[model samples]
Target: MNQNLVIALAQVNPTVGDIDGNLARARAVRAEAAAAGADLVVGGELLVAGYPPEDLVLKPAFIDRVEAAVEAFARETADGGPAFLLGAPWQMRGRLFNAALLLDGGRIAAVTRKYDLPNYGVFDEKRVFAAGPLPEPIPFRDARLGVLICEDMWTAAATAALAERGADLLLVLNGSPFEFDKPDVRLDLARARAAESGRPLAYVNLVGGQDELVFDGDSFVIDASGAVMARLESWDERMAVTRWRARDGVWVCEPAAVAARPVGEEAIFAALVTGLRDYVDKNGFPGIVLGMSGGIDSALSAAVAVDALGADRVRLVAMPSPYTSRASVEDAAETARLLGAKLESVSIEPAMQAFGHMLAGLFAGRPADETEENIQARARAVTLMALSNKFGHMLLTTGNKSEMSVGYATLYGDMCGGYSVLKDVYKTTVFALARWRNRERPAGALGPGGRVIPERVITKPPSAELKPNQTDQDTLPPYDELDAILRGLVEDERSIAEMTAGGFDETTVRRVWRMLHRAEYKRRQAPPGVKITHRAFGRDRRYPLTNRFTDLA
Candidate 1:
């Protein structure tokens, strides 16, 4: 028997529910792999129907169409150049399954269904697909290959079963979403699995943006000794080929070119860019327009938009009120100029005055307070919305997670937009991203390089500028302290007592917790944004608006 194999990993992006388009992409990639003399071509999980088809899989008609497409793809392999392993939904015995098919010789040779279904934190696979039975390795050209779909590899049982069944190599397909530090976590898991099974492993992950989730395709190959042999680039689309040969009675993969992975803040920034770009282009938006206040949040949002869509497609509007400082105006203009985007100045003084005059009679005895400040914000929102309507540009809201955690943002005002670019980002990280953009521009960015965000914007005290000498600190805790408390409550779900014992002030923690619970109503109405953390506000954490149960313990 031949002891050599060539496998091509197709790291292509697929739009959800675009069956025809997805199949075309698959055919194109399979042709490329065949030309390269690969023995087999493998794709990501759910490649035919796209990952997370969600409730779409419940429709029998959709599954029929997907099966038809898979058959058509299988027929094309009759030319005998390369075999294909493609992902699709299968219906058998009135049960739906997430399945991978082996296509060779103008027909499907075998099928493997997913054994494990993930149910927590942006995953509801169990809700849509029935759990498949334990799988056996399939016979290939010269070896027995074991297939593990995504979550199946996270546990040791599946690998052990495949190894016990005499599988020679393990191939894992994934639709894994990108999170901070996820690459390290994935590598560690692969190493452990390889060590346990005593076989080489190949992993291919889906790449692209799907609503709030961004899949960073860091596909890799590892030797049985638990060393990385090849790694594909993240945040981009490409096909990586790995060659294997049997030596000393053990199959080993040859070392190939490995792409470096982005880490920390850089990985976070890349995710943001990919998420925004796909949302705009896939949704068919003409361009994007955002309110460019001189503060760091808006500055960072504008930079991300320009980088994702280019300076020409990004429009910046600075709506200054009576309390808007000259320094703010200068900073906004300077930032726009540096990024090579046009800044449109729209003063909201007249609109604010008109609203105040209209409400003067109703506020005869009430003292002027946050109500008046909200009027200024609402007026700016109206101006921005008008531009969005007239120009057909998608409005991008710039509120960060810190403000969203507390009841700090005005509803129907700054929160009014088609999308929230910084909805999942913390205020502290916002400042850091602004500085990072100035230092280094990311790859595939369309904007001009060097100091995209002005320095003063990063150093200045953050403010809504609704009143004289107003700063965020007047109404909220310092960002560092506030963010720490927020992570404890929102991400970690820690109790008030726990946070206090961890060196946080009791009174401050209680106050922030109260604000966090009170703002659930606002967050419910906020626009969708990219999720970078493991526990983002939207799909990850769900809480009732009327709940009075406080974590005083």
Candidate 2:
């Protein structure tokens, strides 16, 4: 009788520098898979010290810690009921290579180093890892399996090399970050690579939001005919075991379908909400607190917080000033009530007047300008932070991506938060998600009745309420137009000429670029947000902290 194999793809979300913790994670997954009679399990890149550990690999002690933990893992699997294949940074001959190691029978079975180090966009793998030679697949039971780390599978050479070395099955471990429509793109790539390798492939990815970037697991398997046989859920933790049959002396795969991931606003909403909840929970925060401004951004943030934690765990402050309109105050109040949160109003007028009188002498020569406007924002910030300090609640800053990109926000004023909830979400998206969230309530929504965000807030022109009769359009272009230009330039990497060619007013295009470039320093200091795109401001979009690059096209 031909031998059959059942393999488990463990999509593990590992934390960096927590070697013991990571190893424990590996063991737990391994034990689960072994209990299900699985022959092997695959984990993602840098499963030991975590992906993008960056310079942590430079420390000899860190590497030693990883090695020690790996040895301990090997010891725990001494009887070797299930083989483990996972990525880790390995050092030999005083050099580091991005490696995939196979552990079985209390020892290292084989280690394959990554040959391709991506150096584009957000990746700087070449700087950290030395390229290594092509590796042959490890033969076990009835299948010859080749292991490739993240970057190697992106290129055809590694697959070709493995095929030339007589690999019958290909397994990949990935730490791929989430972007709009990336799941389909990844599935297509996996299919092509599997057909090219002339073998079935199993792909496992790490899950969870890290800083600005979120890794959506959604690990999958593709058959020899390049048809996807199994799929996993995105942005969530899941485990599944697939059976492989030995048919006519060749390995064949059968898999289970992963529940489809949420799409568009729903997907982005879940990512942002989960990002906030996990960041707060993992960082040891008691609760989340934010100021409700009757603005779409804060309203969405409040909804997310209430959805993430219970409504009881989310609190709101309404520290309105003279510039804040009556309608806005009422809207904020109603929104808070809908979200089942007890809203507090701390009038910042006294503080504002006090500060205004104090700054009278210092501003004697200056005209009344944005300084006064910023004073209102600063007053609100101080009030919120004071509440946070008194109650030990983590302040969740509410500023959408458009404002964050253009220095429209006050630095210490609105940016005062333990974490920024929507830093990666653009203004247009904020509007859409606010409407969408109101339409479709999350399972744990705190609101008792109708949509929390009022139709007035959605339809009304956005305003900072920093000054009388002020609106966002007064300082910035309409959100639709601005987002069009931004999507072209930032996401599509279109240049000034490209934006101009795409029917944008040349002057407006150049001015927007200027705003984006000038505001890099501000974004650098802003709290991290959920990364729903391929290139979030923090990890993906990097610029010189000090640079003066302006496009005049």
List per-candidate RMSD values in Å.
1.3, 2.1
lDDT tens digits by residue: candidate 1, 401-478: 999999799999999998887888999999888888899989888888899988999999999999999999999999
lDDT accuracy of residue 541 in candidate 2: 85
- Where does candidate 2 clash, by residue pair? none
Q: The CA-based lDDT of model 2 is what? A: 0.83
Score candidate 1 by lDDT: 0.90
lDDT of 2 at 185: 83
Where does model 1 exceed 4 Å of error? none
On lDDT, the candidate that comes out on top is 1
Each prediction's TM-score against the native?
0.98, 0.94
Model 1 per-residue lDDT at 107: 88
**Candidate 1 structure, TM-score to reference:** 0.98
lDDT of 1 at 314: 94
Could you tell me which 10 consecutive residues in candidate 1 have the lowest summed lDDT? 244-253
Q: Model 2, poorest ten-residue lDDT window?
A: 441-450
